[model samples]
Each structure stands twice: as structure tokens, then as C-alpha cells.
Target: MRLFFKKRSTFKLFLKLTDWNNLLNSLTQNVIGIINSTKDSFTGDGVFENKERLGFLLKTAEEKEIKILDVGGVSTKPGFKEVRYEQELKRFNFFISNYFGKFKLSVDTMNYEIARHALENNFEIVNDVSGFNDLKMIQLIVEKAPKIILVHRHPNSSDIQEKMNYKDVVKEVRDHLEEKIENLISHGVDKSRISIDPGLGFGKSMEDSQKLFDNLEYFSFGFPLVVGYSKKKFAQNLEMTHEELYDHCIKSGVSLVRLHIAS
Candidate 1:
């Protein structure tokens, strides 16, 4: 399988590959854009709940040639309200059909039913925030879509401040991901098709988050790294502005940075 990258004005075009394993091993920088589909997103850009606004955003992303668009219907931030499956499915389908149907789509969900539905609708990736706690969801991915992203998370924890306890932030996160990777491999998921995320603000405190970012090299884990630190509470309190944060992310060797600000 061969992958080609072309620059067309502001958009970048990524040609599909017949062999996904080879493509994943290739050293290439890919930019993934996130669409905040919930009103309670930590980022202030929750106004995108409007379909028209979402359409415009999608058009702009296509024009810019983003490699992937991750649509997240549920907000996993601290103190987030529990969103029902019905509501999530409604938003999920709407965003997929209206904005992401023609592009490479990734659904940000931990529910088995939701992930299965998204995969059935041609979504190429799954962003599981629960770190594959749902055995059924893991089985579905292994049996159906072998390529999926497994994020590290502290199960049964909701508050960010409470989940920051770690003997060694970098080592613990890496080991946790390695364990998950081995589990997936044992279950028949291809190692080349897997991606790992450190989950910066998911359940970490400001200090732990800083340590994770500082020790990013230690947690490379032989897979693509995705760091999502856009507009998080830690950034909001920092002396730097959003633009500065974006520049910081770019310099941090983060393969993909999920941002809420307009690019």
C-alpha cells in the first residue's frame, strides 16, 4: 500500500492506503481536528452545537486538509453531566452524516453500542476515553475494526484532582498503555493499528499533567502520541494565551493536538 500527501492551497490531501500497517509505521506528521459536539465542552467553543455552525467548521477543516476529524458528543471533563445514550446517538449520527460523512471520521465514545454504530457507519477510528474498560467494546473492535485508539484513564474516577495519584506519572501511564496494548494484541488486534494517548487532563492534576508533558519522550511507547491540552483548565490558568498554548503543543512533539480554537 502506498500513501501520498499533496498540498492543495490550504488543504492537505492524504491518499488512502491498501496496507494500513505500513501506513502507520511511516514517519509522517498528521493533524487531527476535534469537533466539540457538546454544550459543556471544557473549551468555550460549545456554540458549535448548531448544525449550520458545524457545517461551516467542517468545510473550513476540509479546506485546510485536516487528516482526521474527531467528533465528541459527550464531555468527559470534571463535573460533567451524564449524557444519555439516546442523546449521544442523535448527536453522533447528525455530525457524521452532516459534516464528516465524506472525510475520515473518529468517534469519541466509550459506549459499546455507540462505538459499534459509528464503526458500522464507516468511522475509521474509535477514541475510547475509558481505556477499554468495557469488554464488549474491546471485543467489537477486535472482531470488527482492529484499528482503534485506546486512551489511558483511571477507572471509577470522575474528578480530575482526585485521580492524579501516581507513583511515577510517566512510567505508570506507559505501563498502563503497554498492558492495554498487550491485551488488545492477545485479543487479535494488530499492534501496528494501535495508537496511544496519555490523556493529559482526563483525570490528572496540574502537576501530574505537567510531568506527563515533560516526560513525553519516556512515554513514546512505539506508537503515535496524541496530546489533548487545548483550552483545558490548566491552560486557562496559565499566564500564556491560547495562541501560546498552541505553539507550545507544536513544540512538545505531540503528533496530534486537539484544539477548540479556530485555526
Candidate 2:
């Protein structure tokens, strides 16, 4: 199904297409299927570089009736070097030209340019792992006010690195996320266009990541949360399957999830 989002004088007008209330009403019992459209995702599910046809994968996910589709162009796994801008846009544009209009789509990118392109070309949301650091990124969201998934991570580090140091992991996370949220609002972004992701594997240690999941309720901050723990080292240590962990997040009030498998 195609989504219709029109920009108007008001920010709330653009939110009409987020399937926003669907996220709210399904918080207790649903999953947002993720499709890593990149070449080298951490979980080995990326389809962009495989010999298989991308259409087959997209068709399969649609057949499964997945509610939302999130596509990322670059691997966020630690130590994966940054993708050049041209290459990133090439992957994103390929998928956008073919499959975006057919799903409740989210484009995952940290780059302002890619996000801007997606926003203009009808992608319904931006899953921003960089916390909207760029002024243009902030302006795009504030002006166009599309849905966004704000992931929590420090600005000082890359996507993958040594375990970050945090004195009080839970408190620090709340402080950091709150600051970013407030910053976006101060710069004119509507809070309703925002969703929170604790970013389990981005830069946190096993313990810190676990603590955030344990206290996931604390960061709700009146916004829907998108939780992802699949293939995480900390979750591996506990031996919980992806579904088990997702069920737990749902029970703990998670509104959406990012996954390696869209089906």
C-alpha cells in the first residue's frame, strides 16, 4: 500500500502518515520488521551485496505482512569504516526507486544528505542513529516534520569502538537522550515526530546495555520506543532468542523494534 504524506503549514499535518497511532496502539503486542538494505550489516541479513535478487527478499517480507520496513544503507557495526557518500546514496536510491512507496518505510542513515533526500522523495521516516546532530537534519525534521527514530549514542565516538565509559549508565542515558530531545524541540522540531531507541549495541558495554533494557520504561519520556537486541553480545550472554527478548521489550512498553529479519 502506498502512503500519502503532504507537507502543509503545520507540523502535525505531516505526522498524518507515520501510521503513528498504529505504533501507539500496538505497543503491547507487535513488531516492526526491519530490512537491512546495506551490504554489510552486523547480523548478516543485508541483501544489497548478495547474489540474490533484492526483489525476492522484498516480496517475501511483504508476503509475511510485515507492518513496517526499515532499510539502512551503511553498516553501523563497530569498525565498519564509513561508507562514502556517493556509495551510500547509490544504495538508497536504488531501493527508493523500486520499493519505498509500497511499504510503511523507514530509511536509516546518519548522514544529513541521505536523510534529506529520503525526506523529499517520500520515505516516511528517518531512523537517525546520530541523534540529528546536523543543523540541516534538525531543520528538515522541523520544517517537514517526518517521523524519526532518535537513537542514543555519544557524539565523541564512532558507530563501533571500545566500550564507552559511563558513571551511571541509566541516568547518563536519560540525560543524554533528554538533552537531544530538548535540543531538537528548542530548534523547532515537534516532539511528536520523534521516537526513542536505546541503541543497545551502538557504543555501550554489556552491562550498560542490559541496564537500559532493564529500565527501558524510564526512558519512555512520553514517546514511543523502538527496541532492538537481536544478535547483541549482552543478549547473547543471556541466551535469549530474538523473539524472547522482543516479547520482553513489548511487555516492558516498547512500541517498535528493529530486526535483522523482516519476516
Candidate 3:
């Protein structure tokens, strides 16, 4: 696969491929396009409402040369309505079946069944926002040997909508990622095969989420760090435009920044 880079007036961007084994690396351009396949995305960019929107977003992603896509079937915003597994499967399956080989794919799911199906269908990354709290999810990752993104969700709540208090957001999130990384390593997964996500808005209050983002580099524990702050409420509250937020992420030296369709 060819990797395309956009030229900046100040500097020329560069990318390093991992022998075609994985599409992600620290040197990769810092944007991973997002595909919200559900009907109720907070960003109002869900393709379920208008199928034509998916085509438009795809065209935009192609124009931006976004090679890696992070697709989520259900919304993860606070107070999000729970979606049935079959409903999630329909949306995810449609995209996977039709665009399997067009771009590198990452399945954003907390369900073991969905993760398993995606891995079986050749998805390269499993982005479990629940931190792989489910043993079955970990087992599947071990069996499939696909790269995984372990996100920092508050352990006290199973639902992403529930907010949890944090004493020190940075240390707590860092500790959570560290523990998960150790667990994956102990299970025989290589260090390079795993990535960490700060999980910006899930289970976090707006203040806590902003604090976490401000200290994003603290969560980087010798592994690739992935951050998903695109279209988040906390980001908007800060009065920073989307371009400014993305620029902040790039300057933070993160491996990947999950982004939404450019509007």
C-alpha cells in the first residue's frame, strides 16, 4: 500500500512502514479517520441517517489520504442509548464486507463477539475502549495476534456514559494503561503490538477529560499512544477550534489522533 503525505509550508512530512505487517507506527502521520456507523453520533456525522454521507466521508478521507479508519457502530457519548449486538453487527458488517481491503481497519468495540468477528475478517486493530476488562477479549487478541488499543476507562463503571471521579487524572489513567500493558505483555503479546488510548470523554467529566488531554504525554509508557478527542464536548468547551485541537495533538507527539470527517 502506498502512504501519502501532505506537504506543509514549514516542513515535509514523512512516514515509515513496518514491512507491511502493520499500518501504524510512531512515525505515521497523526490522523486516523473515524467512521461512526450509528445513527446518533454527537458530532452529527453518523452515516446511518443518510447513507450518502458515508460516500461523502469516504471521498473526504481519500482526499486527505487517511489510510487507517477507526469504525464504531454505537455511540459512546455520555447517556448514549444502548444498542443491541445484532444492530451493531449489521452496520459494522456492511462496512467490513464492502471495504475490507481498501484501507487498514480498526474495530472500535467493547464486545468480544464483535472483536472476534472483526479479527476473523482481517481487521488489523482491535480498539477496546473498555481496556479489555473482559477476559474473553484478551483471549481472542492472544489467539489472533492482532494489534490492540487499550483505552483508559474508569474501572468502577461498565457503561461509558457513567462519569467517575478521579483524584489525579494523569496518574490514575497512566496507572491503568501501565497495568493493562503489563497484562498484555505477560500474555505473550509483544510491546510493539499494543497501543494505549487515553479515552478522552468516556467515563470522564469534562474537567477531568481536559486535564487528561493537557497531560497526554504522561500516559505514554514506552508504547504508541492513541488519543481520541475529535468532536468531544470538552474540546469545544475550551474554545479551541478543531484545527487548533488537532494541532495540539500533533505537537504532543502522539502516535495517532482519531479524527472525524472534515466538515
Candidate 4:
């Protein structure tokens, strides 16, 4: 299918698209389908590097009616090789330039420059897993005013995988999110435009991650919650099946889940 940009106001479309109450309350869970552009994704589901697979997965996503597609060029997994800004931009452009479909787009990147390019190119959401710690990234959000997914990682660590001890994982994560949200609002970003992710596997042990997931309700401070639970190491250790976990997430008022197509 060809890229189709609807002849409508983007801001209005965004508001219409993100009907928060409907999404949170709906029995049908909404998902932000994860599509990696690099070859080293933790789940081995990268697509943009392989044209054939990319096409197939895009088709699958369309057929599956995935409304929000989170496209990432860099792998946040531990030991993932660092991709230069140019290479990551090229990978993102390859996908953005080629596909325009019914689904809204979310660019998953920690780099401010990459997020700027995606926003310039009409990507709707900025899924910054670095928790918007970068001042430049925050300034970009202030200027562009795009929907964002602010993730939580340990403050002491530089990357997503370096686990740090938490006196209380749930409370710590909630406080981190609360602070981030306040920062965004102080910078003039509408709180309604922001969503949150607890960053499972980003910096916590499996026990900590599980504890946060179990107490997801604690983080429900009016803003919608976005979760990326697919293939998380913590989920493997849960007593319940993935299906049960997912159902629980939806029931817990999770607004969006970053999931693979198979899920």
C-alpha cells in the first residue's frame, strides 16, 4: 500500500486518535506495534534493513489493524552496538519515506536529533526510552509539541540495562515518572499529550520489574500508561501466562502496549 497522508489537521487528528478514556476503558486492548529498523533488536524482529521482511511485516501490521506503530532504528538492549546518527536517520527515513498507512507513527529513539527528524517528517509520537533526560530533547518537545512516551530508567546508570538497587521499585518508578511529567508541563507541554512507560528490563532486576508491573495502578496519576512488555525477561518468570498478564494489563488501565505482531 502507498503512503497516504490524510488531508486533515494533524493536531485535531491526534486528539481524535488518542481518545484516552475510550482507549483506557475499552475491552479491546490498543497496541503500539514494535518494528525495529536495525538488525540487532533484542527480539530479532528488525525489518527496515531487510526490504522483503519489512514489506511483509508492514502488510501484517495493516492486516492486523495496528493503529500505532513504534519504529526504532537503534537497539536499546545491553551490549547493542552504537549506531551513528546518520545511519539511524537513514534507517528511519527508509521506513518513513516508503510507508504511509492507516496507522499513526511513533519514533522510538533516545537521540534528540533523530527525534527532531522524525517529528519534522510527521511522526506522531516520540518514544524516548532515555526518560527525556536530555535538555535538548526536552527543548525539542517544547518546540514541536508531539505526543511522547516518557520511560523510567535508573538515575545512576547511563544505559537501559545497568541494574541499580532500589529501596522500593514501585515507589521509585512512580516518583521518577511524576518528576518527568512535571518537568514536561513546566516546559509548556500539555500533560494530556504525555504517556508513561515503567521501562521494564531497562534497569531493574526481574523481581523489581515484576513488582512494578503488579503495582501498575500506583502509577496511575491521571496520565495514561504505555507499556512495553513483549519478550521482557521478567515476564518469563511470572507465574501467570502471557495472555493472563496482558489481560491484567488492559484491566489495569494500560493505554497502550508496545507489542510484536504475533502478540
Candidate 5:
């Protein structure tokens, strides 16, 4: 399947060469998947030196018919070190070229250059944790691709506990997501192809994260909602095993989950 983005005077056009309607029709239930790469990725899923393990995980996901497989080289966890563009590109190229088409691919990156590379390699989606902090990333997606996932996060913030200063957590997250949606629409990203994620542990206290989840329905923004709470500190607090946490996230209306374990 191939997707094309064409820009005209006013609105942009998204052209698909495959039967997208059929594909969507086939996906009747919400999906259960995993985000399989990280560098101190909060949940300890980052395996920079273990490329073979990453490939094995992708193989297992394919065998299980997982709906989405998010591959990210950079860790967005608090106080994470920034990765150079060249290094990210190399890692992305290696992963995609070796494991492309194993499953639906969503590249987790905030850098426009990395996003562009993922799209050029036929990745189906771009997961930006910075909530569109980089304008070039937005422009590339608007001009070259239609499907993208915008996750809310403050670029200047660090730890989740320290970033909790919202008057109303739910309202604040909803408003920020609304702003992102408007920005994408203005820049020509098809509203139909956009999704919203309220960065679960990105910069929210455990209590704040709970409030956001409790009020998730209020911030749907007329788009599909994705929640990434797999193996997070909050989930771990439940004292459940990895498998239990995965199942819990699936049952909690999470469209896609970011998991460290393959199960």
C-alpha cells in the first residue's frame, strides 16, 4: 500500500493506492501493540546495544498479529539524553530495512528529519511526543504524509512530578491537544488522519495522569485516542506482572499501548 500527499491552493489531498476502507473495516476492535525501542524509556524497554532482541520482538508481534508496532530509537523519558540525527537515522534505517512490513509501523520521533526518513521508508505513522514542537516535522507530514499521531508534552519540562502545575489537569491537557489539532489543520494535515495522545507519564504526576485518564472522554477532540500507560510507574504501582499490565491497558480503552515486554 502507498500513500501520497498533494497540496493545492487551500486544502491538502491524501491519496491512497490501496483499499484503506477495507483495511479500516477489518480493524473492528481496538488494537493491542507494543512500542519496542527505548533509551532509558521510562519502562526500561530501551535496548540500544541489543538490535537482535528488537528484531525478535518484532517477529513475535507479527506472529501475534499485533495491530501496531511503534519503533523509537530516542527515549522521551525525563532527563533522557538527546540522540544525534545521524545516529537516529542509522538506527531507523537498520530497523526498517530489516523488519519493514512485519507489522504496521509507527515511528516514535520528535525530530522532523527522522520523521521524514520514516515516512520515506513507508512507515504508516509518525508519533511525536513533543506535540509538534518542531515546525519542520509538521510541515513534512503535511506535505508528504497524511497519517500522524501528536502526543502532548512540554519541550521545556523534565520530570513528570515537577511538570505538574495545571489549574485543572483534564482541562489543561484537553486545551493543549485542541491547540495542536488546530495547528495541524491549519498546516494542511487531514483532520481525519490525525490522532491525539495525552502523554501518560511524559510530564504528569501520577495523580495528574490518573485525572487525565479519568477524564479522557472529554478530550477526544473528535479523533481516535491513544493512551500509553504500559509498564509505567503508575501501572507498576498496581503490583501486577508485565502480562497483567498489558491486559489492563488493553481493557482500559487504550487504542495503542507502549509496552516493554513482548507479551
Candidate 6:
């Protein structure tokens, strides 16, 4: 709630248009492939069966040359049943023990227990749609020292809340991220280990998400920027393929792009 940057402004960093692997600590932007382990995702990729799905995750990452793989144990979309901590960790542990050291890993979960477990198994990033709202999550992240992605959400009508309200969408999102970043730093988390996601299609409407995508540079927050524009309903609304939207984002200075499948 406390705005960190009084005089807000966008941060600029140049990356080779064709060579985006160097954008995030020299990691390629080929893709941050999404491998959902849940049973019911709105996008239709969730797999409850572990052995087969883990194989899919590994094979997809390997074949596509995707450097970062984001494994979501629980369904994060609205109207889905909640996944118990036990179930969530089970999927994550199996994946972490097998493929952790082989590649960079991010777990899309908001539960502190699951996050702590993933970090123990050498997971490097936490992509929390709740914007890391839990104090316990913040504590674990501070102690474990993995990258944290705080996604913007406006508390909403569904089980997933995106309660965002603002006249200037970009400025509001930027202010919110900066405020959260300052709070994390004050609580002993390293500034360099923080990143922000605009939470496309989460709390924001299609228009708000588009504004955030267009103004990606404004919310860099001096940390890595992750653009998640793949398979979203908003892309469908605009009558543009996810790949088409993805290219537009990269041109606007997206360093890391999270996708349902690697392009």
C-alpha cells in the first residue's frame, strides 16, 4: 500500500532483438516453458499423472531448448479446486529431485511450505500470483534466497482474487511492485533476487493486461522482468495468436517470457 517510488519512471535496458538469452543473466529467452502438474487447468495442460507428465516436462524442455522450466503443482486459475500442500509438494519433489540441477527451475505456487520444499530441492524462483502476500512465504524466501516474482492481482469475485483498482494501470502496477520490493528488502531479502510479473490475465482485465504488456519497461523495478503472455484469454479476445503477442512483448523489452509451450 505504501508507494516506494514517489517520482515513478521506467528503467531502460537494451538487449539484442535476436539474442534475448543474454537478457536475464545471459539465460536465453527461447522460452520458460510451462509444465502443469495439476489435474484441471483452464488452459487444458494439467496432468495428474506424474511419471508421464514429468517426462513431458523434461522432453519438452530438452527438445525445445527452453532454459527455464516453470512447474505448477497446484491449479492457480479461478474456479479450480484447491490442491493440498501434500499433493502439491509431491509433484514438486518428484520433479525437483530428478531435473533440478539439470536446468533452471521455477515453481508457480503461493504456499510457504511448498515453496520452502522447492527451495530445499534447489529450485531457484518463486512465481506467486498472490504477490507473495504471506509473511511466512516472505520469511522462507528471505532465508532461502531464491528469486521471487511478485505478481499483481486485484482481489476478485472468484476463488482467485485480483482486487486491483486504479485509474492509471501501469503506474498503479509499478507502484504496487515497488512498494512490495521495498518491503521485501526491508525484511532482509536481497534486492537483486527480486523480479516482478504483471500477472497478465490474473487480476487485470484484457485492456489492463495489454497496457502492462505495452509498458513492460516501466515495471522493471531494477530486477528481471518476466512476461507471461501465452495462451491467455486476452490474446484470444484480441484475435491474435499467443506467438504474435509474444513477439510484440519481446520487441517492447521483455527479458523473460513464460509460455504454456515453448515456441
Best by lDDT: 4
The count of backbone overlaps in candidate 5 is 1
Using lDDT as the yardstick, the better of models 3 and 6 is 3
TM-score of each: 0.81, 0.84, 0.87, 0.87, 0.79, 0.83
Please write out the lDDT profile of model 4 over residues 81-108, one tens digit for every residue.
Answer: 7789999998998888777577678899
Maximum-TM-score candidate: 4
Give the alpha carbon lDDT tens digit for every residue of 185-262 in model 5. 898887767777898877787788777765665754456567777656765565655555445444444444454435
Superposed model 5: Cα runs more than 4 Å off: 1-24, 35-40, 47-51, 154-162, 238-254, 261-263
Positional deviation of residue 242's Cα in model 3 after best superposition, in angstroms: 2.6
Worst 10 residues of 1 by lDDT: 1-10
Taken over the whole model, the C-alpha lDDT of each candidate is 0.68, 0.71, 0.75, 0.77, 0.64, 0.69
Q: Tens digit of lDDT per residue, candidate 6, span 1-263?
A: 11011111132454332222233544444457787876677777665565666676577666655677788888767556777888888777666555532677788898999888778777788888778778999999888888777787543424344445669989877787788788888999877677678788776678887777778868654565787877676666776555556666666666567877522
Q: Distance (Å) between predicted and true CA of 223, model 5? A: 0.3
Query: 1-263, model 1: which lDDT tens digit per residue?
Result: 11122331221213232333343333233456778777777655553358877876777676656657787888877777778999988777767666644566778887889988988888888888888877898788877854577788764455332465787878888888888888888887766667778888777888888778666666554666677766566665677655555555545544556654263
Residue range 158-232, candidate 2, lDDT tens digits:
444456898898888888888888898899987777888888877888888888888887876677778887667
Pairs of colliding residues, candidate 5:
38-46
Off by over 4 Å in 4: 1-29
Of the pair 1 and 2, which is ahead by lDDT?
Answer: 2
Clashes of 3: 0
lDDT-based ranking: 4, 3, 2, 6, 1, 5
Spell out the clash pairs found in candidate 3: none
**Candidate 3, residue 3: how far the Cα is off, in Å:** 20
Candidate order by TM-score, decreasing, is 4, 3, 2, 6, 1, 5
